[model samples]
Each structure stands twice: as structure tokens, then as C-alpha cells.
Target: MRLPSKALIAILFATAALPAAAQDTAAVPQSATAAALECGDDFATWKQNLANEARTAGVGEKGLSALANATLDQKVLDRDRAQGVFSQTFTQFSERMISDYRLKHGAANLQKYGTYFAKGEQDYGVPGPVVAAFWALETDFGAVQGNFNSLNALVTLAHDCRRPDLFRPQIVPLMTLIDRNVLPADVKGAWAGEIGQTQILPSDYLARGVDGDGDGIVDLRNSPADVILTTARKIESRGWKRGEPWVQEIRVPAEMDWALTGRTNKLPLADWAKMGITNRDGSALQDNGLKAGVVLPMGRKGPAFLTYENYDVYLEWNQSATYTLTAAHLAARLAGQPAFDRGNPDAGLTGDAMKALQQKLHDKGYDVGGIDGILGTNTREAIRQEQMRLKLPVDGWPTDELLADL
Candidate 1:
């Protein structure tokens, strides 16, 4: 795809060319006692403590001052919670996300930055399609990075008890970024403090940035070379294997052993082939020792994929099955795979009905995570167990009959 015009400017480091004196101009407000950043504490008190923590972490005066200006955003928490599950089926999500524009644009990006993408693969082992898929998904190739104040998003998320362990560590890194003049204090990004075109958090942004262009700076928001290489570096650091397959669409027989389905029962590709697994176009299975699992997103009858070892990286990037699977499928599409076969899967459950099912499963001593209606990994696992017990199809999708049986 053509590089979005907005990405050509160095807005990420708008202050990098300025003398260090001009950056981080905000001043930390004075406080009598540094309170611990507990969830229920007063907002003003908690903010002061946040600044204190940043200062103790060696954040410079301006970084700490910027922390002082953070506002408590209720919407950040809502957004984070809302992302607990991607309830759409694989076909639904993939069709919506992988649009004609994205398909055409992603192909263009492969040709436009062929040299850099090849170099990234040579350096980091992640292929062009994999990295570009995330680049497209995160911000639509930099066209729609969020408008949330990243500072506020970070601090707001850091204070919430639900994910303090995850967001708290990000605070120091972001302040350090601002202090280093790598990012402006008021830089806007996603609601989760993700910066740049790939929507990376400040922690990853700080540690994994790569200067792909020979400009002596790492500006992921501007340079496609930088984004391409830095994204590869990030994925590599997260355990990507070079020249290995991540996902492949596959077809499974109807009368197979249901117990061997899902990612939980990972076996060699040869074993999966023995169980009547074949490629989507009716080709032979790998017949080798690659760890393979069947992912029937809607159910046994839905679109299926044979996931490989490298597929774990997608899970690490985002835990939602729908999102990760769609991303993997989109990467394959960007690499010239045709559209997936939307099989005649059984009807899925509504959100409210799913929540009720989860509650019933919970009452039956099955750990469905929570009664939140989102079919997360734990809930899906529980449903599979119940499906096995009920002698139903063992795909993870919780059906109405599965709910009624529970």
C-alpha cells in the first residue's frame, strides 16, 4: 500500500530536533506526601504518586512534569475491558478486516519496500506478510492511529487494579522516551499507550525500535523502512522462527476423533494427517514433525486452519483467537493465499446467551474464567471439555445445545 501521507512527517519526534531544554516543559505539581498508587485513592493524590514513581525511576524533570499533567480517563478502562474478547467468528472478522483496500495496499507495500522487507526477513527471520499484516491491522497502515492522549491512557490504565502489573511497568519506559526526546509529551496514540503506526506500547517502542533508514533516528511513525524493520525486530525478539510456517488453511474429515481437535491437542503434522487432516485444497498434509493443531473457529463445520509453532507469536501479540487467527489468515492472503472457504458451521451463541452458558458452566465447577459472555481461551477450553463429556462435537464453539446440556 502507498505510505499514508501523514506518516512521512517526523511527528513522533517533533521535539527531537529541538534542544533538550525545550522538551518536557510541563512541571510536576508539588505534593506533601507521595501516596502509593492504589486503585481507590484520590485522583490528585494518585497522580502525584505517579510522578514520584517516575522521578524515582530516573525520569528527568520534564518527564515527571508531563506525568503531572495526566488526566484520569474512564474510557481507557472501558476500551481495555471491551477488548477482553473478540466474539466474532473467524470468517466474520477476517472478511471485515482484510478488505479490498488492504489487500491491494499490502501487495503494493511488499513491492514498494521490497528491499527493506527482504532485509528485515534476512535480519530478523519474520517474513514480509507477517509483519505487514500487523502493520495493516494495528493502525490501517498508519492511517488511523488513535486520538487518545497516550500519557493519560498509560497513567489511567496503570492505576486500574485489573491490569496494574501490565500497565504499571509501561509508565517508566514512556517517561524515559519523553526524557530522551524520542517522543513528545503530548504524543497521541491508542487508548492503551500504543505509539506509532504499528501501535506498539512504549515499553516495546523503547526497547525494540530499529533505525531502518540511514537517518540516525528510529521514527516508526514516519519511515516505512523503520517501521518494517522495527516490526521485524520486535517480532523476532518475541520468538519468531525464520522461514517457518505460521498458519495454513486446512480441511478435516467429518467423522474424526474430536478429542484430537483444538490447539490443546497439538501433535505432529503426520499424526494430524493420519486423523484425516488435509490442506484446504485437498492436498496432502505435511507428513512431518511440525507441531500442528486444528482451529475450528465456529465449530467443527466452520473454517479450519492448521496452526504451526510460529503461530504462537500471533497469540503473544494479541490473545483473542478471532483477531490472531484473522491476522494469520490475512498474512497468508497478503502473501497470495486465496480467500478461505466459509463452511456451513452451526449457528453461534449470542453474547447474553453465551454469558448464561458461562455461568452454568461455572456452576458445574468448570472454570470458564468469568460470566462475562466473551468466549475466551479458558471458556473455550471448558466448552470443549463439556462437549467431550456430552458426546457432542468437540470444537470449542459453545453451541445452544452445548449451553442447554451444561
Candidate 2:
């Protein structure tokens, strides 16, 4: 593992410097509108007030004009919801992210950007394949960065009730960038308003983005170097350790303690070695003096991993084991490593079964929200609550046995 480059570090730090005031107003669009309409009794006047607020926040006359002209379409909202549903499942999400297409393309990227990766490795201490894997996952090698208008998406989400406080400030920066011609007024991106090659949020881009290609403009959408380095910078900022492995496939002893799994507990390498934990190849644990935890992502029967701080660093990038696993697997493939020996068993569940489970949980007074078969946060939380209520292991996972009982 290599350290992040100074330039990349600077970019990461700058990007994370979001204004506190902006965070205060980050709400989703529809929810915001509903709140305003309810409180003010006038939707038109409420929108005007929002526009005036944008102007006061330095969105500028031109940006405000564009925003005023922009209309919220139900179709965009529907599309976003559909996409969001698709991303909820770890099994399905990981399968696509770590698919053969990504692995093949990631390997090709390593070769295409060999010099860049080599230099990045030396200068930033970030592995080349790791950087490439992030690229593959974020935007599919820049092929499908998204199609939603960046401003519209941000404004919509900000005005919506779910997370208006988090997205409110983004509107100002987005508008300011457009006003300054740093970004086009009609910039397109993911449904959540993230833009460019690395899927960076507008606020992050405004603060931390760099012209890594030295083109005098930090265009994450078009500049590979900027996107790659910016990602490396984010990893570094999250405290990725240099010269250390993120995770290692391990052979867990059949009789070994299973209580050590997850991030809750850690043991020194010496302690783990004393406890008879070894690498899959039967090698001893490294005497690196660092603490690590066991992670059985699938279950007791599945492959286990001894995860390091760098694994946590990767988690900080996406906060999902599925996303981190896909990135790690892709990185390994890019480095010519073999895929995991086992496949995901919980790969798919029929829509009907999902809906049934959702309804059961909801009937039991667990807030699964409407039984739509879409596994969003509410559904997962409800599942966890149900598991706890049933005295089952609280992994928040859905299984055939659990569904049958329900």
C-alpha cells in the first residue's frame, strides 16, 4: 500500500471542506416543498422564497434564472426511485459491480494507465489496481456517469424532505459553478447530484477537485487523472495505511472462536497467530504490530477475511461491505489475482417473495413501508427489528428460512 500523493491529499482535504451553513439546509426537494406548502399555504410563493434564498446565498442572477426555468418532472423522480431500489441489495449490487465486464476493463485500464498507476503508486503510495477499481465501480470506466441534470437532481433532492438539510448548500455551489462557467448549467450526473468521473458531489468537487492533468480546469467528468487521483486522495483522507494490505483471505479454524467477527473487536497479529489463525495458504500472520478483526461477510461457512485498517478506509469510501468487496475483488483481478472461490448464495430473491416479507414485517408493526418489494433503508431496518423480535440473529439479512417463518 502506498500513501496518497501530496496533491491528491490536498484535493481530498479541500473537497471535504463543506460549508456548515450548507449542511443545515440539505433536504430532499419534494419533502422541502411539502413542508413549505404546508406551512406557508402557497406552493408558488414558497418556490419563490427558495429562489430568493438561492440568490442571497450567492447563486447569482443567471443561476437563479436557470433554476427558475427548470421544472421538476415526475418521470425523473420515478427513475431515481427505480435506480435506488436496484442498488439496495448487496448481492445484486456486488454481482454487477464485480462482474466480468468490470474485471476485464479494470485489467485493461491498468495497462492503459500503466505509467500513471506506477507513478501514483510511488508518489501517493496508493496501489494502481485499487485506483483503477474505484474508477470501474464509480462510473464503469467513465462510460455511464449518469444522465440526470446535476442541478435539477441536487435541487430536487435538497427540496425533498428526506435529506434537505444535507443537500441545501450544494445548490448554491452548483449554481455558483454554473454561473462561473466552471460547470455547465445543465451538467448531467447521477440522480443524487454527484458529478464527473468519480461521482463526486458538487460540494466535494468545488472544494477538493484538482486539475490533475494540468489542463487549468478540474473536470472530473473528462479528466482521467483528476478522477483517479481524487479518489486516491479520498482514500488517503480516510486513513488508508501505506505498505499494508487492506484485507487478507484467511483460513478460520473450525473450532476457533467465531465471536471475533465484525468490527466490534480487534486482536493483535501475535494474538491471532497464537489463536491459530493463518492465511488461506497456511502461512503465519504477519508480525506487523497492527490490530485486525475477523470478518465473515457471508456467514460461518463462507470464506473469512482478516481485515485491517485499510479495509475500514475502503469502507469509509462506501460504507457497504458489498461495495468494498466489489472494489477489493476488482482490484485483485486487476492485479491478476483469482476471484473468490465461493459465489454469493443470496444472489436473488423474487419480487413477490420480497413483497411478502415486507408485508409480513409491516403487519408485525415493523416499519417496512408499503411492501413494495424494494429493499430500502426502511425495509432493512424493519428486517433487523423483526429478527431481534423473533430472537433470531440480528444480521438484518433476509433468508428463505426467515421468510418461511414470517
Candidate 3:
């Protein structure tokens, strides 16, 4: 269930470097009104209003000029509207993300850039394997960073009201970058606006950028050192514990309380051991004197993990649990861990079918929240309760038979 690498767009800024002289060089085009005729009047008006705000925020003339020709990208809108359901097993995700190509390439990159990794580890307290995992997972070590024009993507998303709050704020920092000439107007990235090696958002780039190379400028797209170290710093800023494990796959006893499953229970390791949880190989669970929550990724059957505080740092990077798990698992593999067992199960339901199932469960008062088709915590819990009611396997996963029954 790797998160679809649909653009990870973001903005960046060099606020202090933006001078009035630099702003004056790029003039706002007089044809903005005519270009509005192409993207529609609403988009034109939105751009104008935002441009005014950018001016007040010190974006200066060059940034305003860049925005004057901004065009709407339908692909960005389409990608935003699209939502995903986690259906792939851990084996599937691992095979796709941790392919031999990635493993070999990632290891090679680790060696090639050993100095940066070492400095990153020393400065940010994040391991080289973890940073490499992120690099491999996000844009495949920068090989497949999307080619969409990041400015157009951000402007289009900001104009679209569906999620303006999230996309609009990013525009200013990007304009700041343009004003400072740190990024060219034609710079491209994923459709969603994420840029650079780690596919970082613009706000994050501005906040967490590090001069990993000796050069003063933090060039994320071109400098692998900056990219890796920036990522390490960003995770450390987001509360990555220095030496704590992110997650460990574990075996659970048949009689273990199903209620204790999920990512928020926060039971101590000893308490979980008392409840019959142990290492995946059925060895006694080690008492690390730390609290952990159980993550039943595919319910009680597929794969279970004891997620520690560091797991939350992965969530901070990507909200999707599946995506975080992929990064963590990749990190483990890079550290020489073997593949874990994966149980065979039927193919999961599609997004539409899952939406219908969520609607059905919600209608039956199972509290699936809204019918967006995403199998979030509410929907999974609803499925679990319904499974219990129907005397079926209470794994919280949906099946065709369960849909028919509903």
C-alpha cells in the first residue's frame, strides 16, 4: 500500500535575499488580463488577488510577474480529487518500494554520500538507513521527481477552493524564491507541488533546509548532501527519537484483546507482553521500558507492529500509515533485516466498493464517519464491529462477501 507518488508539491523561499532591485527586473506582464481569458475569469481573479497579497508579503515584482502568466493545470485538480484506499499487503508494498534496484542503488548512494549521512546522523540524530529509505521512497532517489511546472500546479491548486487553505499559503514562499532568483520560473516538480530530492513541500523547505554541502546555498534539487541532511533535520525537528526503533513486527496471541489493536493504545512493552504479545518469531517480548501502540495494518491477520514514538515522526512526513510503514520497512531492510511473513488473502475491494461499504456501515449506525471510501480509523473500526456482529473474522478488512451481506 505505497502511497501513490502523485506529486508531493511544496514551495520554498529565500526571504532575506530578496532585494527590491531583483524584484524590479521581472515586470508583471500587461497581458495578464488576456491570459485570464484562457484559464477562465475566476482563475484570473484569484491570481490577481493572490498577487496583491504576495506584493504585500514582499514577493516584489519578479514574483508578481511570474504569477501573471500562471495557468490552471487540470491534472493537479484531478490528482487532488483522487483519494486512495490501502489494499496492498506489506509484501506487495515492500516488493515495489524496496526492489533490488532501489536496494543496490540506495546502498551505493549511502556509500557515495557517506560524509553527508554521517554529518546528518551527527547533527540531526537520524540514521543513514532511515534517510536513505525516505530518499528511495520519495521520487525514487530523485530519479522520478515529477516534471510538472511547480508554479502552475501551486497556482491552480490555490485557485481551486476545495483545499485552498492548504495550497494557498504555499504560494507566497514560492514567490519569495522567484523574487530572490533562487529558483527559476520554469522550475518543475510533481503535480502537487513537492520539490527537491525528498519531495518536500515549500514551507518545509524554507523551514528545514540545511547547507549540507560547504556551499552556503541549500540547493535541494541538485545537492544530494543538502537533500539528505535536510530530510534528517526535518524528521528530527518533528520529534524523531535519536536511537529508538520506529516499529517492529510482532506476533500476537489468539486470545489477545482485539480492542488493544490500532495506533493509539499506548501500552507499555511489559503490559503488552503480559497480554501475550511477543516478537514475530514468538520469542518473549523484550521489556524496553518504553510505551508502544499496536498497529494492525491488515487487521489481526496480515502484519502487526509495535510502533514507538519514532513512528509518529514517519506519520509527520506522510499522514498515510501505509506510506510510513513502507519507509520504516525499507529502513529495516537497509539495515539487513530479512523479509517477514505475509499471509495470503483475497484481493481487497476497490475505492468505489469501499465507499459503498462505508455508506452501508454508516447507515447501519456503525460510525464510519463520512462516505469518502478511504478506510480510515473510523471505517476500519466500523468494519471490525460489523464483523463481530456477523460472526465473521474480525480483522477489520472488507470482503466481497461482507459487502454483499451489508
* Candidate that would win on TM-score: 1
> Which candidate leads the pack in lDDT?
1
Q: Whole-model lDDT, candidate 2?
A: 0.64
lDDT of 2 at 77: 53
Q: What is the C-alpha lDDT of each candidate?
A: 0.75, 0.64, 0.72
Ranking by lDDT: 1, 3, 2
RMSD of candidate 2 to the truth, in angstroms, is 7.3
The number of clashing residue pairs in model 3 is 9
How much does each candidate deviate from the true structure in C-alpha RMSD?
A: 7.0, 7.3, 7.3
Each model's backbone clash number: 2, 32, 9
Which sections of candidate 1 miss by over 4 Å?
Answer: 1-37, 83-85
Tens-digit lDDT track of model 3 for 16-96 = 111211221123322323233334337666677778777877788888998997888897677666543244444554566
Q: How close is candidate 1 to the true structure, as a TM-score?
A: 0.88
- Cα shift from native, residue 242, model 3 (Å): 1.6
Looking at model 2, how many pairs of residues clash? 32
Cα misplacement distance, residue 219 of candidate 2 (Å): 1.2
The candidate with the higher TM-score, 1 or 3, is: 1
